[model samples]
Target chain A: MCAMTSAQRVFTTLSHQEPDRVPLALNLVLRGARELGLSIRDYFSDPANVVEAQLRLQQRFRSDVLFGFFHAALEYEAWGGEVVFTEDGPPNSGAPVLGSHQPLSSLRLPELAASKGLLKVLQAIEAMKARVGDEVPILGVAVSPYSLPVLQLGFDRYIELLLGDRAEFWTLMEQNIAFCQSWANAQLAAGASAIVYFDPLASPTLVPRSLYQDTGFQVAQRTFAGLKGPTVTLLASGRSLGVLDDLAATGTLGVGVSCDEDLAQIKAACRGRLCVIGNLNGLAMVDWSPAEAERQVKAALAQAGPGGGFILCDTHGEIPWWVPDDTLMALGEAVQTWGRYPLVGAEAHA
Target chain B: MEARTLRFEAALLSMDRVLCRSLLQEAMGEERQLEGIEHLLGPALAHIGDRWEAGELALTQVYMGGRICEDLLADLCPTSSTPVAGGPRIGVGVLLDQHQLGKRIVASSLRSCGFQVLDYGQGLEPLELARLARKDQVPILMVSVLMLNSALRLRELREALGEGPERPRLVVGGAPFRFNPRLWQEVGADAVGQTGVDAVAIAQRLLEESCAP
Candidate 1:
């Protein structure tokens, strides 16, 4: 096997082609920075600071892929949702400017290029592309329609409306899907090689399978259809494993499994069609020692690596802010050292 | 058995109805509203929680059953009524390090149970919350942090409010407290609620206890 760019490794794995080694996709953001003795507030507000932090992360971990940005609020900010920006922290979504009872005719979705936070994200993407686009695959993150609703209405209001009204729900879904489609396409146009659609709120843990099918599925289907590049859909919560096959059918390049899903079950459900990009516990990385982090990463590799369709990553999102820098480094080192092909089967390891 | 069954059945039907409403309202938003959830959902969940604590129901059964209840709640109850009081309001929010579900649930439940709940939503900063607390002259500051790291913000908020003549009472909750009960003390919360209902009860109790003096 030869060394491959993280983009090549991820794209190849998604295509089910053999890669030099399993790609390690680091969702580096606030938490990753905290581990490195950097401030989360400082990185997000300053584009240059973000680049410096990301470059530092890449230098420290030598991860297969170096990804930037954190949280799914960027598109929300662009889509008429107000963001209450914190000086040294991730931004919070303000109350929805548009209420549910308001006629669908009232809300016209914003063009992706014209949105607020999106330009910053685009600028970051362009900056990253200029610097490292050739060396690594740049993944642009966007919120799924289902998640966008959560941001716009606030999680509580969104969930309530979902329970209370069905017809209007589908309508909202359509509108959000259109919004995400345009947003994702713009990112791809701006030089993002891949788009990661994060539906953090669409976890089966919160919504039933039937509701997910009825409401979230179609929006996801349409959003993925609008994307020009390889796309990854992250069903961020673990309880969605029961609907893994349903998610895989969205025609995404891969599905990001949460820490709670069994690797074997996800792989079985994916059936070599979609790649799998997770199962390592993000919370553990926050608190575990370096040796422990390495051990967990190695264990994940043993379970998820073999057969070329796995991209090692934290089950969902970035490492939390409290994790030690050494632990994160060890995780990267473990993936680099032990994530080679022909993974020793779990039974053999036992 | 009959009363329990009646409440359970009412709860189940109510949960189903709420779930139906939530599914229909999926377009409205994602936040769990307490006003819509209070009537049947709250009592049912309280019943379920009590039953589980008494060993009358299994954890798996409660979890599975609660998820069914939550799914209904998620759809039906989305958003709390904006706090009505004209006093200094403490704008409580979830730390970026934590999940907002538990906090939102508690905030809404508190609102219905009669506290002026200013839900700052999820992934909020401690300084912002503290600023809101000061601006609102919020008598009680409740911060719900599920992750241990996010819990550190409570201490930061406390420091921000340090030695103030009008510092509000601080309350904290969520899963992290289950293992490390001392986190409430460490984070400088005056009290901590173990569950949503307990949160309401604790807040009320704290208020009552304070007012009595």
Candidate 2:
């Protein structure tokens, strides 16, 4: 077989065709900053730095995906909300901007072109596209309209609003869906291959399936339907197997699963419908031995490598900056060694 | 389960707060306020927690149940400063992450069960948390972390607090620890709570163990 470029490998896998090996997509967001010897806050402050760091990281980690995300808080930051970045972990939105006192009526969607921080992210995506072209796939991220309220209103408050007042919840969703469509379409226009529709709150782990069916599931369906490019709905909230049908019904090309789920089961469920992209325990990766990393990669390959719809990735959307370099290196090396199509030692492990 | 408890659990799971409040009133009519919570509300939530663990119930169910129970307890049962006299001092806080839903639920659940808890608040660094726990003389500290980086800091916290009879027994819970079952032990925590209900049970057992010696 001819050697495939990272883009080819990912596209091939998404098409359910055998790539040379399972594509590696280490969700290195903050880790990109770490590679550049800059603070997460400093690295993300400049679009040029974000581009340079991500390209350098792709060179180092050899991941198939170039992340076009800084933090979810950036989405809210564009709405005149504040974001607080720390030395460790992703930034969090400061003191939620929406609640009973403030209300959704007080806010209006900011023009994506005018929002400096979001414009910078789009600029980074455009720059990354120019540099890599179609040789590698750059992924843009947008929090789903159903789940974006977690940033605007805190989790508890959001849940309260969602369950308590249908009118306010739908009104809030209308505003968020508009921003989400605009933001996602802008990224697609900037040359991202697909938008990762991050909807953690949609996961059954967080909300009841019946409630999700009534709220988030329908919102995701509408949001994904409006996106200009391919999308992958990521439920990082855990145990998303129950919603495979609903996620597929959202018209996404793939789903980013959680660590607590079974890869083989998810792959089987996604067969012929959606590509399965994850389940690696990002938390456990912080302390994984090289041997353990290899074992996990082999097991994942064994379970899901039979088909071409699997991309190896961390369960959580973003790999924590503190995960050891050696562990990530081991994960990459193991995929290269054991993840070849017509998978070796697959059955023994399976 | 008894008919009243089952009906109450159903009301809680459905997020019918009004129904839950009415049920609690009915239970209070039959028993003392504390007894109603301990026997009725506590068992209902624990059942929901167990079902969540067994993959039969959603976390939202547990969360809403806890919130409703907290609201009911607050209104129906006036909070006494010394709900349980000489109860082991339990401290709860979220380390490094600002997500407070898990901590809020666990803290409320603990209080519902009549345990005295000192909520040190969220975004506490390891050393700062250690200092606060020590100063408060917290015997059992339950820390919640929404991210793995924060969970890993439990090692630093354990080291700072040190190991001794007087040292607070670390009880860890939240997303990371819940995802990885053995992570609590790995991070030097004495135990891990899979859910807020589990935290209540773990705290009670830890308190009983402490009181034994």
Candidate 3:
């Protein structure tokens, strides 16, 4: 059989079929900034800079899927919330726009396409597609409604709304769902292979499991249903089986797991239902020795690689800013070495 | 483990400050206010910290509990003091991190422990923290960095504080510290706290040790 392309491998994995190897990818930020030797502010400004940095990264390391985080810090800015930009990391929201006396019912949705930050993200996606073409899968990201309320209503007020004014919270969830659908559709149309509904705030770490499921998960169900093709749900942390069943029911093609989670349980939850594409502690792996990194890759492949639906990847799909280039390349080396299909037919691919 | 503590936790969980304040006032009555704060409410908030680690409590709820505890502490004590003039009047803040709730909780917990905590809130530059510490002549500087990016600034913060013998003692706690026990130590923080309550205890001890002749 011919060597499958990255998009081919991902699509095959998404279809729950065996591919050339377990698809490998990274969740990256600031790498583009580093490539151009520019501040994050300067690097993230132009679609060309993001594409150039990603292309340079591809030249050094082999990633089966290319992920651009242009959408990561945009939701708050797009929603008219003030964001503080740093040279080192993504933009941070200052305060939530909504408050008491300003009723939730009085709010009007901002035009996501018209928002410069989101428009820049779409521009980056289009530029990535124009340059990379069909060989690699370019994954876009959409912030979930569960995570957006933190910017829209602020944390303190949002919590009160969750417990005291749940009816209004649900209405906000509906609005968030609409927002995500619009954003996801725009990115998909702009040439993204997949757009993961990224929920950094819906994690059990941030909210009660019951509350997350009741409020966040409900919004995610609708949000995921309306997104374009081959999408998945990327939880900031997926350390339990609580939301997997409902997550599989979200109509997403895959589920992104984390290292804190039991891989066996994730495979059990996702196998025959949805694609499973993570578990390696991506952030900490860079600090691990090459031998240990390779060992982990082999271990993940051995455990989760049995089924066809598994696409091996780092947790949450993000590579932290401090990771060294050599360490990242080492991960790719591990993937290329140990990520072969049919343990018996390893020699055939080799 | 008392029934009142459980009821108090329940009141906090409801997110109704009015009902929670009423229940807390009724529980404290007039005499046992300090005991209620340190023993009952303090331990309860610490328990909520454990729940946060176990993914049971929300960030918002924790913030609410912290605010309520702080208010109750103010109502009970009415007057407090730190390490006199040039002593360890501690300065605490969230360092370039978006999540301020944890630091706020830790600050409130320290106040409940009878320390005069000047909380600078969230997204503060490490240099800003150092400048404030120097100007205020604070002896203990506690920082909460819940994210990786925020934790990365600790060395810079240490540099800003300078290595003088009279410089403030540095302490840290948050999600990043929990990830690596030696994270704060690597960043030059003198100490690390496992929880908000633990941070208070640690900060107090660090302050006392610094003030020891």
Scored by lDDT, the top model is 2
Whole-model lDDT for model 3 versus the true structure? 0.73
DockQ of 3: 0.36
Model 2 alpha-carbon miss at residue A127, Å: 1.4
Rate residue A159 of model 3 by lDDT: 72
- Clash statistics: count for each candidate: 41, 0, 3
RMSD of 1: 8.0
Please tell me which model should have the higher DockQ, number 2 or number 3: 2
Q: Which runs of model 1 end up more than 4 angstroms from their true locations?
A: A31-49, A68-71, A99-106, A133-135, A345-350, B1-43, B46-101, B107-142, B146-150, B157-171, B174-213
Candidate achieving higher DockQ, 1 or 2? 2
Predicted candidate 2 versus true structure: per-residue lDDT over B1-213, tens digit per residue: 889899999998877888888888888778775677678877888888899877678776778888888777777666455343234568999887777888888977877677777999887889999999999888889999887767888999999988778899999998887667778888888989988888788987887888895
Q: lDDT of all the models against the reference?
A: 0.64, 0.84, 0.73
lDDT tens per residue, model 1, A1-350 = 67777777777888876687778877666654454455554556656666666767766776666564655666666767666544344555555656656654576788765765677677777777888867788788888888777656655556657777888777888888888777777778877888888875455645656667777777788778777877787766344565676687777778788665678777767758878888777654555788787777777777767777888887765655555778878877877777766565322442
lDDT of 1 at B135: 77
Pairs clashing within candidate 3: A27-A317, A27-A318, A27-A319
Candidate 2 backbone collisions, by pair: none
Among these predicted structures, which one has the highest DockQ? 2
